[model samples]
Target: MGLGKQDRTKAREELAHDQERAERLPELLRSVAEAERALDEARERGALVEEVHEQGVRLDTALTEAMRAAYARERVLVGVGGYTDRIRRRKRLARPEIKQATQVAEHLLTVREAHRLHGIQQAPRSVV
Candidate 1:
């Protein structure tokens, strides 16, 4: 059977919420970019560990929100390959600044790639 009235209403509300988030995707991306930049600068400047951690947290939160919104819009899984391993490798190199910056940059790159892939997936396919 089809959805009942309450279920239909809930579905409609969810759809509308997703649509709103989709509309804000651009803004969210900008915020993520800004956060990434701030984190990178903090790391590069040899800021205190606590300061760098704060900036990293900000970037992480922004990336997470952006990904959530993108998923809501596209309903697809985006793979960021080997992120943990890459971070571990960087950490093992003993370059704290580079490791921190790389961690933030990697996340930002993954989010951008997710958006790009979603766009490609949503593109209209041609018929022969």
Candidate 2:
């Protein structure tokens, strides 16, 4: 027995919905890309490590949830078995860099202030 016309139409509509979501994949990927670039610049500029890590972790969590949602909606949206690892890697890669940079920047700022104070102390005392 063949699927009734109505059943075939329903299947077609479902496929169409899935395909539309697939079209939205590029936009979603672009969002992740923008976040990555901002993260890199933040690391280079000495943004707070714990804070950056928190944000990155949040993004990673969100992206994973998104991938999971898409997968549940359309399992073929991503490659078989490779869908869950991308965000995890991004999170791991970003945490260390931010931590290192923020620590270095904080140390440098402290050293600068110390040196500035020392220079002030050693300056010849002028008569009032």
Candidate 3:
């Protein structure tokens, strides 16, 4: 009923879709492999020309790309799920608490202007 719940549900749904895409990717790869094998066999038997094999190779490449795309979709879904978790954690943190926590040691430094302040540690960036 709430926005948070809705967001969480959407993220979960995306995650499920991503998992399904990941699972299907291997099957698509197998189909490409089978096509490649068939092309090779045809070439050996002289039933098909080089052009036929080339077409098969193109199809294989397309399928490989499709698999990559599917995997990427899955990653996006998983990232959404991670985003949902991050949002929940952020929601619980008070604004003032975050502001205080975000301050760096460098900001507190009463620098001895004459002396090189080498020992003061810097704050770790959120991304790092």
Q: Which of the numbered candidates is closest to the native, going by highest TM-score? A: 1
User: How much is the lDDT of residue 70 in candidate 3?
Assistant: 57
**TM-score attained by model 3:** 0.40
lDDT of each: 0.58, 0.48, 0.49
CA deviation > 4 Å runs, candidate 3: 1-4, 48-58, 61-128
Q: Residue by residue across 1-128, what tens digits does model 3's lDDT show?
A: 34487788887787777666656655665765676566566656765344554645555454555445454443543355454666644553335543342231122222211112332122334474
Model 3 lDDT at residue 93: 38
Task: Give the range of the ten consecutive residues with the poorest summed lDDT in model 3.
Answer: 105-114
lDDT of 1 by residue, 1-128 (tens): 44467765665666667667756767888998898788788878887767766776676677777766665444211112122234544444455554543444456558656644441222234479
TM-score of 2: 0.39
> lDDT tens digits, residues 1-128, model 2?
44566765665665565556656555654664665566566667877766456546544543543443343334333222223346543454356553453443354345335534431222234489
The collision pairs in model 2 are: none
Off by over 4 Å in 1: 75-128
Listed in order, each prediction's TM-score against the native is: 0.58, 0.39, 0.40
lDDT of 1: 0.58
As for TM-score, the candidate ahead, 2 or 3, is 3
